[model samples]
Target: MDNIDKMVGIRIKTRRKELNLTQKDVYAATGISNGNLSEIERGNVLPSSKALVSLSKLLQTSIDWILTGEASIIDNNSPEISNIEYGLKLNESEELIIFMLRSLPLEEQLDVKNYLRAKVAKYEKSELSSTSNHGKNVMDGNSEIA
Candidate 1:
């Protein structure tokens, strides 16, 4: 890999470690594949835009940091999507799911989203049901309820 690639790779690996993420974790969330991720982290291969976008979101950093190492963090509360970075470890299923979701149209994606939301809602409901099964109440308290 070239110097820029090497530098980017180092930054990705460093941030991932800082977050205590394993390669499996990242793979699960980003769907870049463990082997491809390893190469990118090693600076042996340049990452694609899709990969970069997914990585940024998962790493909670920024695309700028991964590519040019300019910015450090992404504004999570911003109205628009920031170039956040994410590269902690991920599992294979999670990675593929993330990858598949990223590739979907907004409308179609809603189905998968609802499915996931139901899963979370079910989990939350089950957990709190013992006390008070207020499903909406539980989701309301989550900052990331969406």
Candidate 2:
């Protein structure tokens, strides 16, 4: 494989692993077979335009990034976290939250941040409580699966 192909394959592989998705998961989502995906990741064969598009959407990146490793900038302050490329990786709800946050005044941003922190704390507490109860239930022979 040539240098560009290898680089593209490496990017694909890296993004896939970052998302904690397997080749089989990608295949199921993109309709690209596992063997073909493996070959693409290995840079043994060039992906077709259709495959590239599908992979880009499934992997939440752009074709340009996949091909040339150049991601379009949306925010200059934080290239990795606040760029259009990073936004593309977020779901619709997350993107909307980011957009709304960006629209708010500087002082309001802190309020929103605090609110989000509180929500996160509440969610973590609930999760911990549920987990502890589940463990107790399992130990007490009251778990459904047991």
- Which number leads on TM-score? 1
Candidate 2 runs further than 4 Å off: 72-146
lDDT string, candidate 2, 1-146, tens digits: 79888888899999889767788778766779989988889988878999998887666677888999897512422334544545546666766787787566434656787889999999999999999999999999898764
Model 2, residue 92: displacement in angstroms?
A: 11
lDDT string, candidate 1, 81-138, tens digits? 3222343555566666666775664345557878999999999887877546355567
Residue range with the least summed lDDT across 10 consecutive positions in model 2: 73-82
Model 2 score (lDDT)? 0.77
User: Lowest summed-lDDT stretch of 10 residues in model 1?
Assistant: 76-85
The lDDT values for all models are 0.75, 0.77
